[model samples]
Target: MTTYLNSLDYARYLDETDELRHFRAEFLVPERDGQPLTYLCGNSLGLQPRRARQALERELMSWQQRGVEGWFEGDAPWLSYHRSCQEPLARLVGARPAEVCPMNNLTVNLHLMLTTFYRPTGTRTKILTLAGDFPSDQYALETHVRSRGLDPAEVLVEVPLRAGEFHWREADLLQVLDQQADTLALVVMSGLHYYNGQVLPMQALAQKARALGIPVGFDLAHAVGNVPLHLHHWDVDFAVWCSYKYLNAGPGGVAGLFVHEKHHKAQAPRLAGWWGYDEARRFEMTQGFVPMPGAAGWQLSTPAILPLAVHRAALGLFEEAGGMERLREKSLRLTGYLEFLLQDINQRYGAPITLMTPPRAEERGCQLSWLVRAEGKVLFDYLGQRGIVGDWREPNCIRLAPAPLYNTFEEVWRVGEALDTFYAASRPRYPF
Candidate 1:
């Protein structure tokens, strides 16, 4: 374990020695007063890689120079544009190249997967998920159930956290699965909770769900690039994620999905389009849809090329960083250092901050969600004014995530310093 200290000099020394420190220069961090802000919100939307703009321009030049010929002839053929993105995405999510495809945005991909996997039949027709999952997921499940002529209120099972708890326990998840085994058609949950920065036991829950004869899927919008995942080894039936967050693709960029190879035959969803057709026959101008063999079969349209260019540029950075394993090791120590600093703040001044995420390093990613007990909005605004870029959730929580790709220990220490000052200076105005 890397021993952390409360001194600024120690932070600078750690940053100076960091193996991944060079990566910070590759991104466009948001700045205040010509100084880079302490950007800790990769969980929301990642900072842009410096290469993204140039990659998009290369695609634009291909369109201009080759005209229609760009589809077949260019550095990146428009026809196979989305394919280049798949390999890196597959590696990130721990699936085979055939099982992953970058395509529609997160929710659209979720609906597409649900169409194929949420196979409702006699007695098994419910979707089990978290109550506070991303609202788009709730809406998708509800509308999909409605399309099947079933009442969402009747068919959807939402699990809430235990009273006063910030995250779900594995026992709570298993018991719900056990009690509702007979009624579950599909089990969909976040790989990591977006609200609390907590990682759920995706593999364990997946194994149990499969054992109960229920097909399981994950909405990995927060998990995909934040932590290490083995969707293939876990035997997850299907999964969906956007590329914009920890993957750093860009705002409103193309998204991706994963489908186990076992379902690649005729059972794959018949959601058809030109791109989803087998590449050999895709441009043949044929009749019926002869779908591509794997998760690529889920495509519904020709991919947006420029967004894909940005995605490709961003995904390549992970490959350059030597994958998530290297990042995870640093993330463990980085998040722990943040926690240590927060505790130090609490101990010294009796601050009112409460950690909402799990303390265990394995149960978290880069983020640490904090519940500020009083003047929550004030503390958050103070953070913003000081050029610290943590995200604010509803009511009273602030989420700070130090991306291993760009954030440094010096930044984390500065955040700790800011919070300590904010709490102590502002304490007299609020009731102690």
Candidate 2:
């Protein structure tokens, strides 16, 4: 068991933390009156980087000064604007620049990728995914299957985890793949499970699906910036992620897609949009479609420069912070501290607040999902009333994501202390 230090002492420890002290100033943390609230909910929506506003303002200024000419004349040329974002985004996902493109939102990218990859025919008509995928992913898969005249119940295979288990075992996942190999058309899972913060074994799952000739894709919304990923090296057929979560790219920011280079020459059918046309002849008012090579071919319409600008500004912070490796190191330590504090609270109250996130540091991200046996909502409200911010996910789980870039260890300690007080004063609202 980890020892819990006093909250006041933990605040002093934050003052001593070299990394902690430097990053807080970079973000525009929310405040009530003059005091900064202890913000730990970066998993949902990240605090804006101080530079994000400036970067966006620059784009607005360029639009005002040049109008359409801004695409070519601005300090950051708008025509090749997305090109500047490609390298850093590629670095984040460990993909070649040609293989990655920041375009559309998460669900839209999923549908586009599905149009290219989820080709169900012959015996391989089933789609396999986790039982508790994010709602958006589940909806995307269901619509895709239904559109193909296949019943979602029959064609969608949701591999269930063991009873009482918080995470799905890799071996169990592989077994499902093997059992359904003959009929499985696509195997899609989140790189990190959203509710529990479980980091799935992407490489292993991708390899197993490949052996069975099944295309594997990932919804990396929660994982891309939270964990270090090598999507291309892992031989994943395709993947999509939103930039707003750990990437801190702002609300409804432009999303990203990865298409392995091997698919570049294949005459795979896609849901085509005009913006995806070959740029060289795009202005020629071409009669026939000539798709751009690589991931750029997935573009559906002209890119949203505003959201992309926000993304560009946000990504600059990530590059300056020395990329995912350093950020992930801080994440592991910060989340570990949160887990430590929660366990201390559990000990004091004899509460059955079990952590749903994986115990191994490598098997999860910064977010920790705690299952409060009683009064979960009341506790959630209490935390919200105080300065500490976290989120509740239905009946029992309260997800607390101590983002590596901005959250302090002292903040984690204070949340633990606050929860302990709330639980002690309140009676159980629901018995589980």
Candidate 3:
């Protein structure tokens, strides 16, 4: 239990002692009015890594020097380019390298994984998810269900948060799983939820689903690189994630997927292409589709080398910063400090704001969601004016995530400072 103080000196002391402090230099933080902004929105999109440009340019040079030969000639040949992303990603998600693959974007990978994993048979014709999930995941599930000729309303089971609650309870989730286990064909949900910044009890959920003979998967868009995951050990059947958010691979960067080794030999239905063919015989260009073993077998089209290059470069920083364990160690304190400051401001100002994210460090990663009454947009704009970058979800939630890799303790403190100033200045407007 670390005691937090609402003081700039203490924030700097925390930053100074942080083992991952120097990793901040590896990224290009955005600036406002000739000064670096306190970026706290890595949960939405991570800052570009300094080496990303060089990585992309190297691929560009290869394309310029060798047109058609670029696929087979370079030191990091385009033919096997996506492989460079696997080891680092494997470490982040806690899967065997063979189980992870960097390929299509998030939704595409979700659809692909769904096509293979969401096998509805007889009475077990349902997909279980959470209410208020990110829009993309919701759409994917609905569309996939409809594609299977099943009514989405009947096929999709959502475990709703209890009335007047912001976060879902683990017990409630487990109970729902137990009740729906007999009919569930698949269990797919976010590992770390997007709207409320809640870290779902994935291990428990997976264990329960496994015991009940239901296939389980996760959308790790908000979880991967934000928290430490053990997908393989948790017995998660499949998972998908985007790189732009926490991976810092730039916008629309190539995404990744994980297919448990147990499913490798299963005769599951897949939307396959030539890239997924047996690598040694890919050049043979024969008719039959024989997918390579492991997650690489999920590939469809030729990988976009430029994004893969950027992905590799961004992942390198994780290796240099000593991986998720060290990054998550700093994340708990950094986000914890921000939570403390927000609580103090709300307490002093008559509680004009509400925190939607779970209070426990174990129930979240780095992001914290705040509900600022009707003045949510006002507070969002105020923070923008002070060069504090965060996200505002429609209706009334502001999300601020101080990434452990590039963000500092001082940045989190500055957000608190800005919020404190806003609350103090606007106290007269509220009728407390």
Candidate 4:
């Protein structure tokens, strides 16, 4: 473990870090006044991988050199482009190659999956989700329910968190599943709570729901690549995740989906497109939809290859750097270090700045949500000005995510110090 003498000495500590030192060169880390921005925002947009430029340039060159033939000729043929991403992505999500498909953006894939899996009929028409899921997920569920002739008010149920808690406990979630077993068609929750970075116990939840014959899905927008997952082994019915966050793909990169093998042949609702047609006869242009066997069947349109190329480039880094296990080992230590530093800062302030993210290493990811007692906005902006790039949630929470792939222990310490300084300097005068 790397040790730091003071906050400013973190830079030297970063230099000494074995894993930390190598990955900095892999990304285009933005600089603030000649110093690299302490980028704690990988929970939003990950840093661009140095290899993406080469990957995209290869495609651009192929397009110029081969035109449409680029589909078949290049080092990476566009015809089988998405396949290149499958294994790496599957490894990240803990699914088999056949069970995972890299395609469509996050919401699009959600809607596509919902079309097949969220078949509501008779009593089993309701969709259950967490109360504060990502806005896009909520919209997709509500819209899908409405489209199926079920009122969102009646068919879409949101399981609320405990009054003072930041996330839903597994027991409470299971109880809801038990209560709604008859009516619940689908239960979708963020695999990791975005705002608080809680990693839901997906295996336990999935097992419980499956035993009751309920299909459970997960929106892994904040979880994938940030934490280790085993969607296949966990028997997750299906899952959707974006690549831009911890996956380090470029903005709006292609998203990924996982469908357990058990559902590969199951008769279910699905929205079809040509890309999902059996690859053997995809060019046959058949009138009837003969879908691919597994998760690939959920693909709706011919994927935008440019974004996929970028994703492949980023995924290669994950593959080369040993895998999620190695990344996660560092993540636990780095995040724990940040938590320790933050607690020190809270003590120094003599003000209540509580951490909303769970304390256990297993229950959380790299992100930490700190709830400032007062004037959160002022403190957030002040941290921004200081080049500590954390994000603020709507009310009083600030999220600092030190991604393991590219972030260092030193950056964690710097962010904590910046928060401490901001809290001390931002106290407003009382008009006595």
Candidate 5:
């Protein structure tokens, strides 16, 4: 309900009074021509935490100084290295520590969850998902269906957006779930749409699926740190996420998985590995795999210590910032300011752009996706040339997400200023 102004002074005033403003210094912002860039692409790849380097160095020292003993002798032992990330991750995604584990990348975890949950018994063989989902999730569903001797065309039930709409409606999505409930064995979807930045109604969807006896999961790559979640209360069966995006865990860093406590004791089929065996008896090199009781049982290999160090350091910042509740408050204001500026620009320049992200604060996170009416690429490039960093998707979408941890209100104002300059200059040439 705060009124936003287009002036730089107002932006600076907001930043000065901001409670989480100190967090901006914790990250290493990207620069162009020796000056800091107006970085607003955390949804694509987060800014590097200043502590990440030191965290990696600590792990390197453990290896250099302890050699073989490093596994047992360090302050944080290598054997339980992945355990360091569990609690913080749980807090971020809303689950118990035992329900979450840092492991392989996003797709690998997705396949594993699908394998365990997609028990398509006779007649109930379909997997419900969002149409135009991130390609990785789509591909994972397709190949997993094929591996199970089912036709993806028949087994994958996709809920499409209504014609000419940029996002899905909750009622429409729930209606499809109700219609397909009889045949659905699983409902796996993105917690937030990557392209349009819409936060789907996860709680409602999960409640409906549980009522219908269909197991549900989420690919929370875009939602994990960007939005608030309560997976346990929602009764989500399982979920997967990558830390490289909003987590700021460096590129290709260790990813995470969650399995609700209810499923921890289920006699489900899993693709097991040595690391997933009972920690107490793991070194026994036994004949059978006695998996760990919780989500940790999903692990596949020796923990990647270096990447985990970086992840631990990055997750620590969230804990220090008082978790997602505090961050979400700031994100609401940051994105709201950007929306206000864009609306002002559209009105002044004859509506040259349209916002694809939902206008309601509860329906989105930090991102605002704009659909440029003309020369989207040119406008995207113009922003880049001015040292403003945002990402462009094909056709006409440009996504700008200001991380509450590092981005300032003044930075959001600069984006508005730059866009105004571009559209004002283009008005004469493009007849806007």
Candidate 6:
């Protein structure tokens, strides 16, 4: 059982005994008022790993010393540099190394994945997704459908939420897939819901789509490093994600994709670039295209070396924490703690802060998006003024993600304390 506590000493004690406590020093935390800022915004942008600078410097020196020769010569050659990051990246998402590759940014990867999977034919022309998915994804699907000379209004099926509901009911989604089975070309599943931080049922959703002969893909931007995912075992057709958020790869770092091994051999309809050509004779100045085997074949151009370097530095820490399973174990506890504290405040002050994220631990990640019953931004701005950095989504949700990789129990306690202070000051004047 979790020890419910409202004291700072209790929070510190939990931190004192935490096995992952030492890993905190590995990240560069932001500060305010001459103190470490209580940063719970990993869902928006993750804190940088300390080793990222050293990793960048190493590559910068190699570039300075070797110039173009850096591609073929050096301890870490740039030509096959993307190869080194495969294992850690694969481990994070639960895929074989052959199934994953670091490539373009999030929306770009989403478009690439759709280029092959979102093939619309005679009757089966629509792409199915939830109503409030990240806007970029909605836009990607919109443009992708438009590119085929097909009308997006007819091809894109966004299921609306139930009456007064904040969460998407899986039953409602499954029914839409079944109802539109004949016309649905693809199902785009978000591994984690971005706004509310709810982790969707990916495996079950894949099974549903597969039963109806509809191919499914995932935009795992929020799910990649924040939650445990098994894309291969779930038989996920294709998936894409950005590394900058929970993976802590810095801003606009390299993203990755997973192509099920089954689709590797002449199956995917790739928009081929020279980088995606077969590695054996890539530099032959060849005219005909021979795609590289497996997920690496999706590469469109030479990678941005600095971002890949920074990503590897971040992955190194995940490996040190003994992979995602261990990190997830701690994540469950930290997020749960935040939920508990928020609930406690909800009852104490009679403040109607309803958690927008899923109630079940299995259905959520580190983030807890709370819907303030009234005047939400007031509480959000209050927290920010107190050096607690959380994200504010419009219409009333404040998202606080106490990332297990760097966030501690004590920081979580301070959030609760800050809320209490906010309530104490604002309750009477604001007429809550």
Per-model TM-score versus the true fold: 0.98, 0.96, 0.98, 0.95, 0.99, 0.98
Give per-residue CA lDDT, model 3, range 1-432, as digits (tens): 989999999999998888888888988989877899999999988999999999999999999999989999979999999888899999999999999999999999999999998888989998889988999999999988898889999999999889999999999999999998889999999999999999999999999999999999999999999999999999999999999989999999999999999999976789999999999999999998999999999999999999999999999998988899988998998899998998888788888779999998899999999898758898899999999999999898899999998899899889889988987788788765
lDDT of 5 by residue, 104-176 (tens): 9999999999989999998899999999999999999999999999999999999998999989999998999
Which residues of candidate 1, in runs, are more than 4 Å off? 430-432
The digit string of per-residue lDDT tens for model 6 on 65-89 reads 9999999999889999999999998
**Winner by lDDT:** 5
Give the number of colliding residue pairs in candidate 6: 0
lDDT value, residue 332 of candidate 6: 91
Which 10 consecutive positions of candidate 3 have the poorest summed lDDT? 423-432
lDDT winner, 3 or 6? 3
**Alpha-carbon error at 388 in model 4, in Å?**
1.0
Alpha-carbon lDDT, every model? 0.89, 0.87, 0.92, 0.85, 0.94, 0.90
Number of the top-ranking candidate, with TM-score as the measure: 5
Better of 3 and 5 by lDDT: 5
In terms of lDDT, which candidate is stronger, 4 or 5?
5
Ranking by lDDT: 5, 3, 6, 1, 2, 4
Backbone clashes under 3 angstroms, per model: 0, 0, 0, 1, 0, 0
| Model 4 misplaced stretches (Cα beyond 4 Å) | 1-11, 426-432
Model 2 segments more than 4 A misplaced: 1-7, 424-432
**Residue range 1-432, candidate 1, lDDT tens digits:** 567799899989888988999999999988778998989999989999999999988989999899989998977788888789889988999999999999988998998988898888999999999989999999999998998899999999999999999999999999999999999999998989999988999999999998998999999998888899999999999999998899999999899999998888755555567778888888788898888878988898988899999999999999999998988988887898899999888877666778999988999898999998887888899989999988998899999999899999999999989988887786677444
